[model samples]
Target: MLIVFGLMIAGGALLGGEGDSADNKSDTSAATKSGSSSDSKLKDNYHVGSVANHKGYKFKVNKVTYYDGSDFDKPKKGNRYVICNVTIKNDTDKKQSYNPMDFQLNANGNSTNMMEILTKENYSQNTLDSGDLDPGASVTGNLIGQANKNANLKLEYQPSVWNDETVKVSLY
Candidate 1:
């Protein structure tokens, strides 16, 4: 009877140890899969009219328009203006500065940035006020990007230019 009891204890310990090792392997694989998906989520684009809260500001994409550049005076030989109208709200009590320069327009596999230099008409009608954002203040305007055509478009906005954290808003 004592021998049988000893055998039972030894078998139980061995089986328990193997089960733990299997659980650990599964846990590791699960964590790895989640980690990979989370990285892609960071670059994922929020839908139009969806609000994204990052750091202290709230951002939303209102509308997108494709122009011949005749209205904005930013037309190249073949390039056109894919203007994204976005609303940025400051939720924090303190003032903040938002430069639309860091954001980019992603269409399919193509990408374009907010042009730093713009003609008076394009700059005035579409540019956001980059001044100190007052508490509870919100500014809405167009962000111009030169694109061949608007297709599967999204706006990639980085609340902090220094970090990889970005919120993408669908423009189409």
Candidate 2:
């Protein structure tokens, strides 16, 4: 009886160990498959009102508006405010962070972050803010930047800090 019990314990450990390794392998493979599939779906350029997916988040640049700035808060000479009304939806099972800083304006070989100064404007309440989004949650707001008045502008969204993949949106 004791011999049978010892053998049963040994067999269980071997089976359990193998099962765990199999589970780990499957998890890794699944992640790889999903990542590859999503990467393939990424496009070269997106336009206003178009949807772009990054990882598990859905982003849309709903509208782009230009501001010459108010009396007290004027843009630099030859520069104007570029405001993108963006919407981000968290499709992942876990919570994610959404910030205006993640959006950048690219023009004339220069990349600039959101213009935080506009956040102090009276219309600032409509500007984007850094916040946490739970699964299925969404946030929509403006990302304000300053760029040359006549420069061709492009907006880039870097969704993940771990990866350098970006979603580009043309603002013609």
Q: Which candidate is the best by TM-score?
A: 2
Top candidate on lDDT is 2
| CA lDDT for candidate 2 | 0.84
Model 1: lDDT of residue 86: 85
lDDT of 1 at 163: 51
Colliding pairs, model 2: none
The list of candidate 1 runs beyond 4 A from truth reads 1-43, 71-74, 116-123, 161-163
Question: What value of lDDT does candidate 1 attain over all alpha carbons?
Answer: 0.73
Query: Can you give the lDDT of residue 152 in candidate 1?
Result: 72
| Per-residue lDDT of model 2, residues 13-53, tens digit only | 99999999999999999999877877546688899999987
Q: TM-scores of the models, in the given order?
A: 0.62, 0.74
